[model samples]
Target: MTSGCFFHEPIRLPIDLNEQSDTLKGTDLIRVSKFYKDSKDGRFMSFLHDDARTLYDVFRKGAKESNNGPCLGWREGPNKPYQWLNYNEALLRAKNFGSGLISVGLAAGPHTLVGLYSQNCPEWILTEQACYTYSLVVVPLYDTLGPDACAFIINQAEINVVVCEDEKKCNLLLDKAPRCLRKLIVIKDTRPTTNQRAKNRGVEILRFEDVERLGAQRNHVELPPKVTDLCTICYTSGTTGNPKGVMLTHQNVVAAISAVILQLSEYKPTYKDTMISFLPLAHMLERCCENAMYLVGGSVGFYSGDIKKLSDDMKALKPTVMPAVPRLLNRMYDKVQTELQRSCMKRILFNMALRAKEGEIKKSIVRNNSTWDKLVFRKIQESLGGRLRLMLIGSAPLAGNVLTFARCALGCLVVEGYGQTECSAPVTLTIQGDYIPEHVGPPVACCCVKLVDVPEMEYYAINNQGEVCVRGTNVFVGYYKDLEKTAEVIDEQGWHHTGDVGMWLPNGSLKIIDRKKHTFKLSQGEYIVPEKIENIYIRSQYVAQVFVHGESLKSCVVGIVVPDVDVVKCWASENGIPGTLSVLCNNPEVKRLILDDMLAWGKDAGLKSFEQVKDIYLHPDPFSIQNGLLTPTLKAKRPQLRAYFKPQIEDLYQQLD
Candidate 1:
């Protein structure tokens, strides 16, 4: 199951059962393998009828196979315990809540409140699956989301029941009680202080123990779900507009998981695999993977709450697999470089390692690593949970240098993935052996990719880089209640146009350059792909967040840069530089240092003159949801950000002369 080659099955599902015109469903699909014909090839090789039902069955089978897999929730101190839950256990817990048309609310961390007229846990194989299956739509709310946005999603979801992590989280919903919400159920290791008024307002709040109590009351409980049941309603983080409530059937999760498992089977043969789940569970990436763990009975551990504590959590969990966002890997690369720069010996060792890595160093100059692990790289590996096997980065682009460095330094492979919530999760992911930084990788098993030209795009690919489109069972039924937007994305042929601009690499891999909609024109009429340009700047240690855009009448590309905190701190100390972030950005010395380095990097990357950053303005702030500079996924919100920093950009442009 572990190799660079992929198996292709040409089976297509029936269209009659598919309610959506552009989707495949039920009875028409079968499994065919390019690698092997038998299921004993150390992979999950069972085929489904191309229906949601079959998909769910396969998922359960995978879960049953990986019975000892753990669901590690988060690291506690130095001992990160791996918590295992069997498929029967998860199913019973989900099903025991039983047949209720309940709405679910999610309070990400503690300190949130659940209102009355609101809310809702656990145990026993039958009860676990039962509770897990209820028509409880889990609405995930982040700590940073504004109250109004939070209220909108809750009301839109009509969430009658909520699952809060702690008391503080319960309070947020409690304040909003008397509105659309009905009940609150908090999932905590222990109970929290009760709010009398909140409870009386038609909101019945209960602790995890209460859930256990409810499970005890179920006599002669129902059997396992038929797989097509509406298990959860996951909402997308609205970047362009209001969030859409995506109703994912048990089938959707199962199908997506099967595709991923089959795709990774080559590199990972056993169901006893382990994964670190740090991405928001609300996200399809984590949700789908979590269910995938169920199929394989794999272990999944939640890292410490903050990114700052991720390294420590990693070591504690010692996960065999990890899923991350590009930002995380990029930051790790920055950290390592900054740390290396701090010491002469470490820097020399790192450069030597890199040279050896690229096979550019002579045998005489390359130092042996027999003692190197303890001397140089053990801390980095330990920070990543030591047992690290493979790292997967999704939701955004990971710089090539970042990926390459981690592979060489950490002695682990970093897999880059591409997908959207609508596809249930993954569509394409990098596999072992044939990974390239420029390409996001190939289509996942059972998925098909096609490239279609955007009539308006003229500067993209040789054959014209088309908008990347995908079709597979992994595709969601459609956006719930948003047919127009759904249609705009998925066409009559069932191919989902991924808004991403990409072309086939010489090796047939897909290379995503930028968002098709995000590409803009300069005053000289020259087209600029900002994402490509920004990726170059972002890979540099001195730059963090970057945005490149043009101004009126001028074909200039300007940037709002957030310098790497660690790199700047180290660089400033060594250079005897001092000032606030803003002052340091404008300091002649700092600007000269960054500009010189960036110019060289850009030149080496072979960027077009127009695509190159003409000037960069240092921004004291990081682009985040709170600041409105970036979308929830950390992508720059172009229009708003460009206008907001118009003055600073103008100043930078003036200085460029």
Candidate 2:
């Protein structure tokens, strides 16, 4: 399908990588698929072709078959969807849903119904997979967006129905029900508000339980969804503005899953794979992984609602694999440190223990030291479901120290990967046996990466810090209904300018430097990478989040830090400091402690003379979505943050000795 004025193509998959690049030399890179037919490996494609048939088909056909069925799609009580449906059960559920639409004789049912989602809630998976079987298009919603934004997407995709999991979300749809949504299904036990606010204009209403009941009653044998029909519409995280819903076909989704799984299989088979579901399934990364779990018959578990409950949930689920962003790993590091600081004796012993562990890792000494793991790290492991063999870190750059410690101390293999929403989430992931530091590993299976200069925008560059461009089947088609914006990213050529600046290492791994938009030239003519600096600041125990800015300023760098309140409170009680965390941040003694920590960390990071942070201020508040300081992906809004802190920054720089 052509994306209006952007490009004209039949949406064919590229078997040859080189030819595909030539075809997309000028178009947006997001439009491509993640996989193509493996001409050399008939067995591989045959495996995928079989998987496309049924959930169990792939598991039976895979090189390694699992004893356990994949997935346990669940909810709390009666009237809810099935509590723990395995792969076969889920497939049956999808068939039931797909056939029910046909049995009901709904119009426009020929076209696939894709769900646009954001939350990690399991319903996203159920609806998505069910729609896939019926040849319906499913679009995932970015729950972080406002009402108007959600309405715009619902209208653009021509979505007829939405299954909202919570009351707040149900109200959001209800508010926009008249102009867009034709049907609204609430997931919770509570009915749509009895108050006038709960009533929506001109939309049919049903509880999510009712819909599942309808599916449960339908025949499970009929199949209508074709591989060629569209499977989903995943909207890109609006780094710029309103998100564009990208159209993905069943082939596209399967291709993405195949690419990632093939790459993963070369390292470890998925027979008994256990993974935690934390990242929202609305994201293509999680969706693709979810599909892989079904295909491989792996076990998947959900995290409890709150992050505080995640540790407890992990202990229960015992996930062997986890796909997450860098921020989660960083937080995990903080959790370890906080536990260590519980007591003076604990702190001393932990330090000495960490040193010993470091010595063992460096020496390549493999010890099945049950005593050490059981006594020290097993509790942490138990908190994560106990069986975590590997943790996948992505979405952003993870601190090298965090990666090292999880491996050494936690006994969990933390592997860092890289990708974007546009590229079905991951292009490169670290293999189990071979991993490289400060690199996003090698491209997965059939994907390819190349660095290129923005000839048009090259006038602003200093070195060979070119944009990290990509070409793969996992690339998206184009922005939905915004040809003008789509054309800007994807040229007539297929190369999608990732906007990220990076270089290829000699060993063929990718090292991301920074986003082109984020790289700024310092007063001393040194190009400063804000992300690099911000990452270093966040590595400090006291700082939760940091933003570095040097725009229209002097040689010295300045930062705004969000102190870890709990850590600060603990430190205050010991030091006999007074008042709340916000008050402590401003207190003379507390400020001195923080500054001392910052200065020491700055030196250790080997900052350039001009790049050292001279003036650092702690914010009473965190940079959250509510405050507009964070993107939907939880990335810092550098511009917004700098503007917000302008007054405080100015006062800090005033020459008042």
Candidate 3:
């Protein structure tokens, strides 16, 4: 099973961790499964998986139990059919890949750093597993990154071996990278055009198959990875400066997965379920999600490189769970709602269904498959392969209205979590049936959370808003090679300053408010959270994307808005307006309509007087990852946005009414 791809294998865990019995120890926290031990310390909660010390151990145990289980699914092309690989076969492949690394004189040690530059795919996982097997630190680079970014990370992390998707990515670094790089491994079978150049430079070129064959023939043995051993140096998506290499150890990842499992005790996701992987593996949250799937013996299907084909992929896989970010979820919501708005009757019935959903929420009910579920909700479900039941949203703050709309209209149980790459991802997650639109639930079993006062920003724990600080086993070691940066975030008390502001709800859930340190003051001496302001304006269907800016001492706000294309097109057809999306965005009347709608949204959000977007400039092109306006996870890069739109913003200030 480990040698090659095969089909018809059912996912099976060595044993159902959920079926293992547990006894509640008279406290709010419980070690609900036999997989872990309950915390006896003074901390509020804890879960120690005594046996699962390292990531390799976790997968090794699962692979032994689910040797022949179908583990991974991917496609050849957008229109191509899907393919499968079993667990035993994947492990063997990874072992061979690891052995191949050793044979090349690239023994895994403290200085060993391997770079993986590719989109999410089965090979990425295989390479990562190989890294784990050899105890080599994996350094992941975003596939969308430019040449400079690629070169910067490779040099900064001192990557000696690099694995890429194709010749294109490999070429970006081959010439510019440091001479320390020894090997270029391509996932594709085709020979790289830069192969000769790499060889001339004394850098070896190995196809993925070559690595596997080397390891299999070499009879590689898996090194026992220690809990404290460095596993990966995950770089943060630098919306501000150069990407920082986050040093995450095997213990950090183990603690994170344990906490995630503790939070999801009720769902008990196991080998029987399936998940769709569309997010980049460079992002720690998505990486963590894939790891959790592998540990639970659940199957994961990789989405094609073209994200526009996700709906088609969904239909083919019929995945049970989907891990997403706010941008993706919001886009899905927008597309579905736009179609529903096509007919007046359809829109009316959708509103009626929303009201019924609100009533069920107010009454604390678990819907026993209602009439609306069959009529409208089921269609949205079918469009997404008809089997998606749970969605895990993270990487950015989700709007309350969007959350409500997803549960009410899309008919999926949506759960939002809050964390960053520094925290190894899920610090807190919403429970399955007990979800609050505003709150992101409590800290996970292994984490201890607190909100510290930030008087400079007028945020205080008493007012229910302060900088969120976390201390736990899941917390990362520190910023790689930057002790000064490490000391700034982690202190003598061992708390990792999250930089994000949050508060505790009456129900003890955590509600993330805004960034504490990055905010600037507006004219009237009001400190404004730019992301919050932008999110509010985006709630209006008229505005697809927005970036809010306020000058020091300026009472009013100016926004750069990207009008929703579908909504604008519909409006143009109905109002006798004639223009493409770009032309309409610059149209005075359309601009007025969008600005008015955004102003109304700000008002509805109960924003301060200074928070109102008094003037707006429309850009036809949306904020995209490619343009550097947005991060890979779709979070706006505020500094970059301001610099790019400086001229428009300056004119807006002068023309302010």
Top TM-score prediction, candidate number? 3
lDDT of each: 0.59, 0.62, 0.76
lDDT of 2 at 502: 70
Better of 1 and 2 by TM-score: 2
Question: In model 3, how large is the Cα lDDT of residue 69?
Answer: 80
Q: Which regions of candidate 2 fall more than 4 Å away from where they truly are? A: 1-70, 73-83, 100-122, 192-200, 212-228, 266-269, 342-371, 454-465, 573-576, 653-657
Alpha-carbon runs more than 4 Å astray in model 3: 1-48, 77-81, 200-202, 357-369, 409-412, 577-586
Cα distance off (Å), candidate 1, residue 187: 1.3
lDDT of 1 at 417: 78
Output the better candidate (1/3) by lDDT.
3
The 10-residue segment of model 1 with minimum total lDDT is: 14-23
TM-score to true structure, per model: 0.81, 0.83, 0.90
lDDT of 3 by residue, 437-495 (tens): 87777666666677789998987876767889887778888998889989999999888
Looking at candidate 2, the ten consecutive residues that score lowest on lDDT are 1-10
Arrange candidates by lDDT, highest first: which order? 3, 2, 1
Score candidate 2 by TM-score against the native: 0.83
Residue 261 local lDDT, model 3: 69
Q: How well is each residue in 1-657 modelled by candidate 1, as lDDT tens digits?
A: 211122222112212111111112221121112222232121322233343253235445655565534333444455555454555555444443443212233332111222221111112122224334432233456554455556777776555555566676777666665376766655653243455756666777666546545654643333334455555555666666676766666566666666666655544435656677667765788767666665555656665566676676666666767777876776677668757766998799877756554441111111113245446666777777666656677887766767766665555545677888877787676655443465676566546666677766663333737777776656666765677978888889777887887766554456777677877777788777777787787667688778877754676787778887767867888888887777787787887777677778888899877777777777767888887776666667788787888898888778866
